[model samples]
Target: MTNARIAALAALGVGALVLAALGAPPLVVAALVAVAGALEVVGQLGPIALRSTLRTPDAVSRAAAAAAALAALVTTGVTAATVCAGAAAVVALGVVWLEGLVGYAWREATRVVERLPGYTAPHSLGARQQVITAGWYLAVVLATLTADGRSGELVLGLAALVVALGTAAAFVLVTRAAIRAKATVTARIAQALRSYDAPVMVYLSGPEGTEYQLGVWLRTLERLSVRLVVVVRETALARVVAGMTSLPVVSAPAMADLEGLQVETFRVALYVNNGAKNGHNVRYRELTHVQLLHGDSDKPSSYNPVTAMFDKIFVAGQAGIDRYAAHGVEIPADKFVVVGRPQVADIAAAAPGAPLRTVLYAPTWTGFNQDNDFGSLDPTGPAIVRALLARGWTVVFRPHPYSLDDARSLAAIEEIHQLLEADAAASGHEHVFGDRASSTMSIVDCFNLSDALVSDVSSVPADYLYSAKPFVITQVDDGPSDAFLDEFPLARASYVARLKEPGSLEAALDALEHDASSSEREAMRSYYLGDFPRDEYADVFGRAVEALVASRCPAPAAPVPGTPGGAR
Candidate 1:
């Protein structure tokens, strides 16, 4: 809980104690106690408006709130009020504790059972508990307000005790049944996996929020002829990926659990990133591990030394092969396979001469560390967008999802969004920002809608090359120089927007309007994205998978029964 919230609860408890010492009116005491009870109920039930402000209360917060409520109840100096408040407090604590236990049980159940398609967890038990707890608190508060005398107070106390005990027993029974249901579902999933036979397995293991890396390859993998499965190291990721694709997803968090699955039938395993958890599956020597990086770029991640572990590395083009050599990361030349980027095949080429040109300012994110921080959003993003708007061009501001991780980058993105939104309203220019730019329309969709591009030293610019349109690539630290072009040869076909130069961005935009680099971009297209026919780009990846499968020698025929140690 936040410190402010804790301080508020502490103040309320102190106020209750002071009021009781001074002998505050019974109605005032009941009001204070009722407020405390209401806050607790709202925290537990969490209505939509309060969802962001009220989190699941911790044991410390719960106990503090209960103490305050008890102190207020005693302020009335009535036995019935005190007894009723105490009973409500116990029920509230029990409900919260049981809710937590149920959530943990559900998670454990999901881990044991591979998630089946269309399976949703039962949430009604927790909902029922919240409703009962809310009603019990309301009843106690009403009994305190409407009770006429001592006889009436005694009746209210007895009724409160009965309801609290009954609710506790009912919760216990419901929790036990939910746990048993989880175990049964797990058994069913295990029984179904025993006869499974998928030859290709996509192994993805990373922290929770980086699911986008795995999402990039799902459509392409689905297009392959071979039967495929997705395996993840985190249970949360398994549930998420299962919903994103129709393919079977299994969560095998431990090495032993992974080995227990039907992996002997898998001839090849594909990986999207070089996360540490990948070591769990890489240890298996019999399977041919292939690295299909999430994006093809000049960034250091493209040539990571850890990539050497894979038997084969599938890249978009020759640029991918040469990137490793330039960075002095040694891997055999035969290990590189140039399967063209099938993702960009659907991106429409530019149709120049529009009256109002739209520039897609898609900056990348600051990478894992300084060495990989190639994004320009924090440095030149606002200036770039301002310049484009100044020139009467519509702006489609699509910042990288990971860029939001940095406060400075996010602030800059928001500033640019406000500038565009205000300009859009006044000048009648349709500008895209927020979810429309980041979520509703994809990066590829943004590419098709724009005439030119201004982005950082990430995959966005590399992928935008398929559009055969003019684009400006920003320099990270210094202004454009021979060193920058040498480091990112892809920039040879782009207008360089030097970070330090006063008018370098405007100059690039001016050059782009005239289509000065049109011929150069056509040549670099083949160099960066391979020379595959546009119509057949997706087929290249599919055929490559077939070749990899055919290249593996067939498993030796099962040995004949009872002759020479089971050898045929």
Candidate 2:
């Protein structure tokens, strides 16, 4: 607690004791406690998380708390005050429970299970929380009846509230049932209507949106010998068939889509993320599910608990093999296939002279929320860019797509662009924020143009490792374990800068461009990516997919290890 709050709490406690000494009713003492609790909660959760309580069961709880306060002031006998005291307890408990629900704070329960590590199916985390809360509420309400002076009326009122909330929950379930039934029927129609057969199904099984990463998998594996079909959940990606790949795009809108389709036809089912829909695809009695992750990065997503479910994981090299084993996910050794990223072949190679000029300042996005977000664009991007510009290196600022989704990141990107716009011509150092400063510029082209990469702990460094070029990765924060650093050897190999230090970027660039960092960078690349035979990674990746199709055996330690939360 802050010193001010601690002192205030002490004073408040003394005042409560003074009121009780003056012969104030017990209900008044209870009311004082409840009000103080509300203040403590406001301090803890803040106002925004508590806002929902103003409309929920918490509203009734607050009213009951008020009645307790009124009774404490007016009631002379014990019965009125006893009932009011019980009401205060009920209200306080209800308000807390309701507020917790509104903010989805109880979802943190999964962290307990997450401690087990490896892929476990998704759990009904929110439902589990509600049950636990209700149990606490019941225990507290019953305890209130054991008070020195209690009434029958308080018991009746508490029972009625329980019955009311239970019915409301049941009604919501019924509404959800209707919606699910309709979806199930639609999915069935999709499966039955299409007479699709493929040896390999590239399952684009994330939620409705966020299938952009699938483009790389599609583009890389398009030249495979096994019959390939793209399975997506949205119809909007029909253009993927026409524009992105040679394979037919199968859109599954619901679960019934899996039921009606011939599951036996596909020899291999490729999975990326552990979306609930993907879980349904895995449940197929026959097909072999391969976890072809979107990218090989040091991020937690790369070695998720969900990975245990795949029959095989098409990993880049030895690094991925060591990663899962080190994280305590014990998958069979044979399942971790060393397939160099086929897409790397498509990325532009380092020019004959690529250590000094035209640096690619590509920083990763601040993930879906703050916790997972590793974006340095806002904190250190401009300082590093200005430093590079000062050094007379032509800078190409390519920000992550999701980075500019928010106002804060968008503003940061704008500052970098404005700096480039004002200074590019004057400094005789031309820069490209092409397509009017949009993400339209391809990553391959970006790699082709720049000599070195400056990125966060994202797939960028892994991808750049293939170019046999120098790159710098940022250490967003301290407290990363020794294991995490080892899993991502690139951090050890390349120019690793702390976000707070712009000079680190300069140091990495200076060393790589003019010193022996190039040799160390190459060794790190070899360690992570294994041996690459020229630029023929596509051929290697194709053979891995073909081998999976040949075996048709599922991988052990599936992500779903029976948890329902494994669902999207």
CA RMSD of all predictions: 6.3, 14.6
**If candidate 2 were superposed on the true structure by all CA atoms, what would the RMSD be?**
14.6
Candidate 2: tens digits of C-alpha lDDT, residues 74-109: 333445434454444455445444543543222111
Using TM-score as the measure, which candidate wins?
1
Error of 1 at 50 (Å): 20
> What's the TM-score of every candidate structure?
0.78, 0.61
C-alpha lDDT values of all predictions: 0.72, 0.60
Q: What lDDT is reached at residue 312 by model 2?
A: 78
Who wins the lDDT comparison?
1
For candidate 1, give the lDDT of residue 173.
74
Superposed by TM-score, candidate 1 places the C-alpha of residue 183 at a distance from the truth, in angstroms, of 5.7
How far is 213's C-alpha from truth in model 1 (Å)?
Answer: 1.6
